[model samples]
Target: MEDRYSAVVDLQGDSKQAAEFSAKNLNKNIMLEVENKDENELVDVVREGYLTTNSGFLKEDVNGGTCCVTALIRKGNLIVSNAGDCRAVMSRNGVAEALTTEEHMDGKANA
Candidate 1:
């Protein structure tokens, strides 16, 4: 069986400081540990969104700020882990199956 794993962390905010800080911290926290499992593991994907600013105010705006982090661990065709608006799907025998659902603040939408 093919063993693979992927992770992604996305940070979005109107303030540059917030986005940069989140991205940096997220990246720093990503690491792999010994698990007695044999497979190729990839580092986490940390993505930072653009910054938003208000022309009227000279300060950073925190409204509508959003950040997302995802982790995928796979072993011998089996995947395991936590995820958040992220999506995972697999196709077998011409059928597609979703693994995880997105997390959103609105409670109605996925992250």
Candidate 2:
């Protein structure tokens, strides 16, 4: 459990760093303001981070685990991604809303 938690934390931290670094470098270069390029880069960074973390675990002979990652950027972008049985929830007013749908063992959403 601890290892899994650490992996998720590392992923989040790395992704955040990537986003910040991308924004800083891109802001300095005026030629990189293409449409949706920043968003695409953010997505790729998150995906690569997840893959790297997973591969690291496999290389270390660690057991598999699940994780839910939620990243809220300063630009009002809310990104939520998960694997296995994890899910994300948000509270609106007095009601609870699920940001992500639950997944069943049969590879179907449990909504």
Candidate 3:
């Protein structure tokens, strides 16, 4: 989020192009944070980051970061991304379907 905030800081007057640039850069940064990893891994890494108070609240201390959900809508389709334990569900044909996988949070990880 620091990257996102810093990126848009220069455009404080908030022109249309700046807003668009901010949005796009934020999306790109999110992707950069999780390169080629699966959703569950992302979830665990974020959880671990928050679990660690090691760096004492610095932006670069991403290993001890916060939790968030990232969603983008374009061309009538929604692309959702998440870290930590949030779940996104949809109902179809009177049945509920979870579009995202839930990360286990029982303090147990594979050795």
lDDT of 3 by residue, 70-99 (tens): 554434545554444566767899999876
RMSD of each: 17.9, 11.8, 13.0
Please give the CA lDDT of all the candidate structures. Answer: 0.37, 0.47, 0.44
Give the lDDT of residue 49 in candidate 2. Answer: 46
Q: Model 1, 2-88: lDDT tens per residue?
A: 999987444343545544554554434332231333444332121111111111122434432333444435454333322233466
Candidate 1: segments with Cα more than 4 A from true spot:
1-12, 15-28, 32-71, 74-84, 102-111
Q: Over 4 Å off in model 3, which ranges?
A: 1-65, 103-111
Selected candidate, larger TM-score, 2 vs 3: 2
* Worst window of 10 by summed lDDT in candidate 1: 46-55
Highest TM-score scorer: 2
Per-residue error (Å), model 3, residue 103 = 5.5
lDDT of 3: 0.44
Best by lDDT: 2
Measured on C-alpha atoms, candidate 2 has an lDDT of 0.47
